[model samples]
Target: MNKQEIGTFLLRVMLGFTFLMHGLSKFQGGLGNISGWFQSIGIPGFMAYVVGTIELVGGIALIFGLGTRIISVLLIFIMAGAILYVKLPAGFMGNGEGTGFELDLVLMIIALHLGLNGSSFLSIDSKLPNRKRGQVSDKMAS
Candidate 1:
């Protein structure tokens, strides 16, 4: 693969792996505790579950390069919501306790990049036939 392809692959792998771990942590009472914390912050408990499930599924999809564009877009929103609802009030430097918005900010940037560029050379979406590749017009001069 070219350097561009390699870079894309690396970005996807790192982002996907990080997100997957975050999601996995949730099911192990990490997310449940987080949900309770959200409730304390005035966020609805059910919404926390919804966001967690989205992160889990979207992170897996991103890792496998399956429907990458869609999953990436979804993750963008999830990260955005997290930043707005949870982190912003805590401030960028966090509540002076090291808990901060930096990680979420980085994830948001990565998700935004994925949403824009989509999966690269190794992705299933790239391998699949697109309309331009599969369809032929009858109004051909050839």
Candidate 2:
């Protein structure tokens, strides 16, 4: 692979692993606790389940380069929600209350990049016939 492809591959894998760990942690540490925390934050408790499932499934798809752009878009939305609802009030340094949106912002930007530029040729999406890079279809030229 070329230099750019290698970089994209690394980004895809790292981002995937990050989300996967976060999702897996909720289940490992206790989904009920996470759900309770969500409720405390004004988000519906049941959303914890939906978020966790999306993170887990999306992470796997990202790691394998199955649907990098689509997964990235979903993850981007999740990070945006996190920044808006959960991290904005905390400020840059957490201000002693909680962590801020810095990390979330970074994740959101990376997801955005992945969504726009897509994964490298090393991904499963690239292996498919007619599909190029992270594309799901080849109706038009890249």
Per-prediction TM-score: 0.80, 0.86
Which pairs clash inside model 2? none
lDDT of 2 at 62: 93
lDDT value, candidate 2, whole model: 0.87
Stretches off by above 4 angstroms in model 1 are: 30-32, 132-142
* Model 1: worst 10 consecutive residues (lDDT sum): 133-142
Name the top TM-score candidate: 2
Kindly list the per-residue Cα lDDT of model 2 for residues 12-82, writing each as its tens digit: 88899999988998889788999999999899999899889878888888999998999999999899889
Q: How accurate locally is residue 38 in candidate 2, as Cα lDDT from 0 to 100?
A: 93
TM-score, candidate number 1? 0.80
Whole-model lDDT per candidate:
0.77, 0.87
* Residue 84 lDDT (model 2): 84
